[model samples]
Target: MKNYIVILLTLITALVSAQSTRKYSNEFMNIGVDAAALGMSNAVVSHTADVNSGYWNPAGLVHLEDNQLSLMHSSYFANIANYNYIGYGMSLDDRSAVGISLIRFGVDDILDTTQLIDDEGNINYDRISTFSTADYGLTFSYARKLPLDGLNFGVNAKIIRRIIGDFASSWGFGLDAGIQFENNSGWKFGIMARDITTTYNAWSIDEEKFEQISGAVDGQNQELPETTEITIPKLEIGMSKKWIFNYDYSLLAAANLNVRFEENNDIFSTSFASINPALGFEFGYTDLVFLRGGVGNFQNERQIDDSENLTFQPNFGVGFKYKGIQIDYAFTDIGDQSAALYSNVFSLKIDFSIFR
Candidate 1:
């Protein structure tokens, strides 16, 4: 497992270190927060209506008439790390609602090896240290119904923070906006703009710790690298349709298209070549048990490389609801067999009618 984690870290480092001209940060922000949504390959932008809706499309929160609370925890990458999420939503009035959400991702008990090797080339077990690294984010969301029927708009303000074993830390801020349209015919549409204001992370590194790392690496470099990056805006469009059978069974199909602008060579040469599409389906039996399946990361065939050509990425989930309480489980395929990069998620939610 440790070797697999090392390989995964290498792949992550290579992706982030791609080009000096096109740098980005806080990629973890893109991970899905709700197990139910992630089980649908993050295709819930159009059809979601729960406390966790703020994470997918804040506008969907207006559809929730009752006070709701949600919690989710996941074992990521074969138990190498942990991810958790929590959300609460309450209607402020008949026309507007508010939601709060939090996310925590971390790795605990990491062995610090700065003192493991002695000057005589002997191992020193007592000199090793352990530390934890984590990332946290809090989001406040507000959604209001439009004067027109079945239309809603929302915004999210997010504050993000990251810690690297007490040696390095960063703070960031971002804004997101979304709109949803629904009708009486079980048709829904949604649009969301994530990081519309361009999130920026400013990192502060402990100079002494960095100097110690430099010395341990035999003085390979005299100075540390830059610690600032900006996350560009991403736009998503989603649509969904539902069908009811015999008044006891319901099936819904949804899809989403994501588009983001990226620079060709420099920050100025911008284009919209980054496109990813996802598909999801869900079936509910008497509104008690639900089954879901989804497929995502659908890139163009021309962009497929040798390593990515033979892999499949799909997700599945199941849920049970009883007396306003719900439990959901999701599984995601990571597409890399050698790295064993799969994940499991579990979530719980409760709702109560505000009118009551």
Candidate 2:
């Protein structure tokens, strides 16, 4: 326990002292799925006792003693995009579990413009068209307890697909792995490696059609080239401590540190930089009702002298469970640039252990 405390303090110090860096590709992968997790600022790496753990840290799935299914939907970026997730987990035996998860992020009703003006220099609304963009992923996960009673390990394999209407598409694959350790003293620690295999997206564009419709009239158009983007690896470490107040009340506190390994702004210098640190708390009453809140993105300060940065955000949520059904809702202010850009996320979870 002393060692864990020391490690947690060390990580917190590093998170505050390290310099921030540029981000990587496939940013949608970083978006949190379930409301319960997001409400706590995505600090669930050490406390994933629900089916949604399949998306955060698969090693936490070994803690599930029942079959479970979870679904979530969010109005992201002030309804500019839609995000959804589905996951199911089942215990294979006393110490083994398996799970599957799916993710979708899309923007619909996008205007596909062909030309803004004609040779007569007049606007033509009839010539404008529309198309949508989408991203999808399917993941399979497995987890098991290690020989050490309190240790667990897990791995996930995933397939990724991205589509831009019918003009271009890409397919990619990746792997993730995680480890978790816990004790009867209410201390839990976790580490997760996202995109450990370095996922890639190979884009193919319909250059001929693009050039024919939008190329310069004077024949000075540049050609499009096929390109591939690789998602950099991200590492997260977290710790949580649970405090039980008698039999009907409990409080939990958790913290997480996120670091990404990718090329710097120079595009040639590659290193790991601390991205953001998150802190969260949850309070439960009678095991039926819960309240959650968290603070995240403490690293991206827009101003150095303002003392309070625009990048810092706060999230809050509420949840309840009845029989086999659980419902959750979360709200977060993600708009540092504007106040109208807040978002809401909702999730439903079902546990089938009673049937057995």
Candidate 3:
């Protein structure tokens, strides 16, 4: 037990320092997947037990009762960006499971005006072209039950791909590990460590295309951008419990503490770290219909008058399940209690059983 405690502290403290640091690198992957989770302000880490768990806490994949497939889609920034996800999970045996997931976040049809002014000094409308910028993540996960009852651990291998039209592209790799434990009293706890190895993205730029716009702006784009980007490690811990009333109505409440190495506007902050708390609740009736709500993304914002104010985002959602198929919808604010508009997120899940 002492050894375990020491290891835990080491993991937490070791993350306090970062090398080759680039904050918010590979950020698109953090936008999250699954409407059910987004509806809960992304507080489902402890109790995620479906195909989507491949993106949340892969340990939960061990709880899959059968083969499953999941898909989700959402639009952000008033439809300027689109995000999509697909996942599959299957139990290898009573004690192990495997999962695979793919995610894409992209902005399409962006007009490129670099060549608008032709070599002859004429403004040619036809020179304007459209292109897309996108990021993709593919993950493979595996989970196994530990010798200790109710304990499970999982690991993920992630491949990241990013593209900017034909001008630039990058490939990155990372690893994630997670553990989940449930007690006899119906309480659950979990921890997830993301990018534990400090993921790196190495870019390959198109010199010809870059040179065309190198002088478009004075003193900008004159030098090639950094060829390498790094993403530091982050941690999240969660706890949850569920209650059933009259064996018909049920409620599950969960909370998560998200920790980052650098100090920021999170609810709790220090020079070396910051902690953000998220709360989520789901109410179910007859195991067929569900209602969910949550509030998270707490931040300390500086007012126009130089004062600080606390703010957060609120989310709500509904879900229906029947005959192994489930559909969920969520209304959420992508911005952290800012002026940005809300977005609609939808997800679908299907379970397959050999007997069925």
In terms of lDDT, which candidate is strongest? 3
Each candidate's lDDT (Cα)?
0.79, 0.79, 0.88
Which wins on TM-score, candidate 1 or candidate 3?
3
- Give the per-residue Cα lDDT of candidate 2 at 265: 28
lDDT of 1 at 252: 87
- What is the Cα-based lDDT of residue 308 in candidate 1? 29
TM-score of the candidate numbered 2? 0.84
lDDT of 2 by residue, 65-167 (tens): 8999999998766688999889999999989899999999999989865555677878898877888999999899999988877888888998899888867
Q: Candidate 2, which segments miss by more than 4 Å at Cα?
A: 1-23, 115-128, 212-220, 223-226, 262-271, 302-310, 334-340, 354-356
lDDT of 3 at 92: 99
Query: Which residue pairs in candidate 2 have backbone atoms (N, alpha carbon, C) closer than 3 angstroms, thus clashing?
Result: none
Clashing pairs in 3: none
Model 1: per-residue lDDT, tens digit, 48-148?
Answer: 87798788888888878789999999877668788888899988888889999999999999998877988788998999999999999899999989887
Model 2 lDDT at residue 8: 38
